[model samples]
Target chain A: MSEDKFDAIVVGGGLAGTVAAYLMANAGLEVVLIERGNFPGSKNMTGGRLYTHSIEKIIPGFTAEAPLERKITRECVTMLTDDSAVGLDYRSTRLGKQGSDSYSVLTSVLDQWLADKAEEAGAQIIAGISIENLIVREGRVCGVIAGDDELEANVTILADGANSLLAQKIGMRAEFKPSQVAVGVKELIRLPASVIEDRFCSSDGEGTASLFVGSPTAGSIGGGFLYTNKESVSLGIVATLSTLVEGNRSAPAMLEALKRHHAVAPLIKNGKLLEYSGHIVLEGGYDMIPKLIGDGVLVVGDGAGFCMNLGYAVRGMDLAIASAECAAKAVIEASGQGDFSAESLAVYRTLLEQGFVLKDMKTYRRFPHFMDSTPRLFDEYPRLAADTMEEMFVVDGRPSIPLRKAVMPHLKRIGIGTLIKDVRKGLGSL
Target chain B: MMEYVDVDEKLAVDKFYVDEDNAHIVLRELGPGDMMQFHTLELACPAGLYECLPDGTVRFDYAGCLECGTCRILCGTTILEKWEFPRGTFGVEYRYG
Candidate 1:
């Protein structure tokens, strides 16, 4: 046991933990961060792209020095059937502008950079040590216990990732329901920088992000994502655990099928597989947020279920940054008053509620339900799009009719009433 | 007709630093109908570490685990006797995650 009690102890050295350590240590507080991985990101994985809006507020012009892959200048959404694809590709300079910018990131490099920033700010980082238990005296968390060592602190922050067993151990959160989370399996495929740019239709230092519906998950309640990196591409599929458990396709099989799909095979024709990874992402939205603040304790990042998936955009890093900021602010305030009680720490929730973290989550609260209930979005819609596209483009000896007349039969196959109902529910949820 | 790669071939590209001292995951003894329950792991484990054997049993190797926690979240304590991440500096490391 250490007799010297630090001001704050952060468990798990990922995005949220490192950010909190950086903030508190920068404010001249005694902070220590513990990581179970050999380094910061050895245990992390993502789809994954980072929205720069929140991180920009933390480190202005971060893209200048950060280990970022590429600025996303092109956006694509493709509806794919087994043999056909209908895509909407949008490219504009507006996307690369300051606040709206995003980048595809590989966390192994990004998280190490963040840990360096926190260390530079005077936070002591202890790596390769798993926290075995929380030191709770009279219902208040005072520090953490790792094996035979007990490190004491005035406040403890749990920034552990998606499967936060520590929070559940303390009764602060419940076990994950299968429907509340999704599994993402990814492959990082290597290609030459020039080859990637030529294939994705991008200039140097810029890339594209594409999302797929239909054939990727084989009619499951999930989708596929692809992000172009400097010399590689991140491609994966995410399906809800509930749906995955009930389905016949294994996650690895789904990824294999996605790679072999005609719509995707050409993009990585000669590429070599660099790394394959898997992770669980919280998709339960606002309703899944657990008890965040307690006496001398706080939860941030995926531990608190701070991730959102809006069909077109998937965000977790931004929300992790914002939540860490709010928690840091509240901790800094509490440290000044020497009051680390639950009442004093309640400011963390207040700050999150007032900021975009909670506001944006609230706006899209029903989206997960909307997706889970609508099966046709993954099945019929792609078939309909593919059939309609074939009607107009596949030229046989037959004369083509008017565009509406040609498309109406395909629409009728899905029933106008069902289509209208789905649209209404989808619009209402969004 | 597209041919798919085997799960082992897909996982071959990944790297894992194993913990020799610890068996991070273990399966409980199977009773009647337990094999079917264990078979779900064969369908859901991203690394395909679990296999239902011909003798009405399941086999699992934790060496190549991605530590994604899908098995833990799905099977809970039912089929798994013990499950935790490999102690520090061990388990699968994602170089390009």
Candidate 2:
């Protein structure tokens, strides 16, 4: 018997929505998960890493079954300036532990798996349909309109995405500023598994996550990332829409420049191109979070802006999964009271406040501002690092200067005060 | 031996703009609104899905688009200007993604 009505309607079959549906349905509430893609992941993309701490709590030991790409055991951060690159590398066996390590999986693969889990948990999964409108009556969301179908629910979860028009349609989220978002352009380059492992200096199944600052974005506010997969590498650049536009560099052009970079080209020197995707990522942290709760409705994932870019690390998947858990728990508690008003749904905020989702965002609240305001870190700093390293290594026997004497001129050019001030600001923010 | 990424192979797999009508059709009907608003979008379109007409009306070719979401976001008409995943298992299927 298809009841046509559900306890909750979860929009967007990505990690947050599917996990929320999975949990709520497991808790004995009827759930319907909706996705516009033909399948769960057809429309999605990412930097391709999922930090699994949160997901492990809900679906324990799930990694044994998930389509994981590689276990990241080596971390590399490269500062590039065309012909030169200065890198910091760290390798540790500690990163390979289950429930703590992160892996790179395409969203198309991961989201489909999550949706299947929700479906297996008795939540109805609906694909190949876009929710055209929210069914609101008397200031409360009650159902959704998809094409000719109108399905009713007691509560609605809007986890659609960063440019979620559905959240804005109900006046639940406001128009975001350009500075509040970034446009990420990505290319998945396919190399052999052995070639990938050898190039990244990783063991057979292990992989590396490389982040590039400076030349990737043509000295823009954003940076580039590369994560090794089983037989390919995920490489891309994320630039603030404002900066990319003002800097007169297309996101595609920036990605091309990054691929041609002397330090980046050799890694995938003979690989075939696999896929390309562009996504609008939420850049603004705590400050950009819109109204999270409303009558019979709650927002999660990128719609709620749960992503954080803290220079060294860019995280969204774990945060998405975490938000899903909190949202599910909140919905369950609300259903227990038989109340679906804003007052009842406020439990979502409380759970986020007590969890890592909000805590991490609050900690990095000042970092985005620092990154945006400090342009020198992108332009001058990478060149200085590369130049200083080159000066130290060159021994032409033509009167070699002392180490400090060699580096002082470059430091003096940017001034010691600016470097000191930037360090202080970076420390204070991070 | 090429020093760059083969985006054409990627473009071959990924689908293009989807909506009630072609994106450029909707944008044209909505009017460019402002040329400056179209600048970022015009430059950022990786698939080169668009072109400008003689008098400055932007002409769009939806074939081989990477569907990067830039034109939709950078458009003054906003994301409402019709860009979606091609219907039902029709877009890029990643081999290693």
Name the candidate that leads on DockQ.
1
Q: Give the clashing pairs for model 1.
A: none
Superposed Cα deviation of residue B64, candidate 1 (Å): 0.4
Q: For model 2 chain A, where is the 10-residue window of minimal lDDT? A: A242-251
lDDT tens string, model 2, B41-94?
655665545544567766565556544456666663552356654443344443
DockQ per candidate: 0.60, 0.34
lDDT of 1 by residue, A319-356 (tens): 99899999999999999999999999999999999999
Clashing pairs in 2: none
Model 1 agreement with the true structure over B26-80: per-residue lDDT tens digits: 8888788676567667767778888766675567888889998888988877878
Please identify model 1 stretches exceeding 4 Å from their true place.
A399-406, B1-5, B54-56
Instruction: Write model 2 residue lDDT over A211-292, tens digit each, in one string.
Output: 8899778767888999999988999888887677777666777888998898889988988877787778898998989899
lDDT of 2 at A169: 85
- Strongest candidate by lDDT: 1
- Give the residue spans of candidate 2 off by over 4 A: A1-3, B1-9, B15-25, B29-33, B51-57, B63-68, B78-97
